[model samples]
Target: MESTGGLRERKKLRTRQAISEAAIALFLEHGYDQVSVADIAAAAEVSKRTLFAYFPTKDDLVLHRIADHEIEAARVVRGRGDGEAPLDALHRHLRARLAERDPITGLCDHPQVVAFYRLVTGTPALQSAAARYVASGEEALAAALRETTPGDGRFAEVTAALAAGQILLVQRALAAANQACIARGMSADEREPDALAEADHAFGLLSGGLAPYRR
Candidate 1:
């Protein structure tokens, strides 16, 4: 049996999912620009106030799908096993995600996932919002790196910042390539081999640059 608080949280999650699914369906059918907040509220069977409580901005209704991952890299770094290098942990994590066909890795070819990717990339507002999210992730990862890396000074901070930026850049580039392949009709299973190889090569290059900070 679940606690009352657990049940309440589950109910809230259901409501949030209902609202998000409703919003995405409408956005896909009608253009994002054409759908209004009031329209989503009606479709989700919630009051405008309820919708606003879950998502403050109209852009958030879409971006919320990825909100949980905004700090993923930071979490990965912070949670890595003792004595494991940060870059190595991150590389392992990415490989595991690719194997799992996680949509965030851009290697999942599910119809809805593909559509979601297309929707975000095609919409300027979503793109802008996503950039902000990426920047936030980068900042978070940098902070994690700074905390974990040895040395205490401006130099250590700068090194962590630079390394974080490079790691994220590589990740974005690999994901973009994977997505492009999928967009071109290659199945995720078919692309997995190439994706793994690319990830290896990209992370290998990063390892050299990040050697000084390795644990």
Candidate 2:
């Protein structure tokens, strides 16, 4: 028999996936604002209450995965190996993500993902909703810095905010580059090499300026 924790986790994952999938399908079909939580729940075969339990809000149906990344970046910084520089750890992780063309890094070529980006970019409500998701990622990075450098006076606080801002800029630049490549007729695969190169360049700039601060 499955442990209670394991069963609960699995059930939660399935419910979240159902809600996200339903929301994406609806957003892709009829635009983001036209779809409602009630519609998403009905489509997913879950009650509105069930959807809220899983997502809290309709914007979350679309922004949940994005929120996960914000938390992940902070964790990566906090968990860097002994003697490893925080920037180095971040660069390594981001490089791996770029190489894999991870969707979170904006390297996705799937029509659905592309459409989703377009939808989010174009819709005022979704754009407004995304502010918190983006801020969460920054906060996570800041928290990681605080955890990693606990006794650095104000260094960690300042550095964390700077690092988060720098990283967010890099993410946005990569997304714009990828979208431009697609607009120029490069297939997602064809665009990834350039995209990764650009990402590496962006990270390199941050790494250079912040190298002295890393411990």
C-alpha TM-scores of all predictions: 0.95, 0.85
Tens digit per residue, CA lDDT, model 2, 69-111: 7677777777878888777787788778867777776777777
lDDT of 2 at 179: 77
Q: How do the residues 1-215 of candidate 1 rate in per-residue lDDT, one tens digit apiece? A: 88999999999999999999999999999989899999999999999999999999999999987888888999999999989878888999999999999988999999999999999889998998898888999999999998886668768888888998999889888988999999999999999999999999999888877876554
Clashing pairs in 2: 70-137
lDDT of 1: 0.91
Candidate 1 residues lying further than 4 Å off, grouped into runs, are 1-3
Error of 1 at 4 (Å): 3.9
Best by TM-score: 1
Measure candidate 1: CA RMSD.
1.4
Instruction: List where candidate 2 sits over 4 angstroms from the true fold.
Output: 3-12, 154-156
Give the TM-score comparing model 2 with the true structure, all chains together: 0.85
Q: Show how many residue pairs clash in every candidate, following the order shown.
A: 0, 1
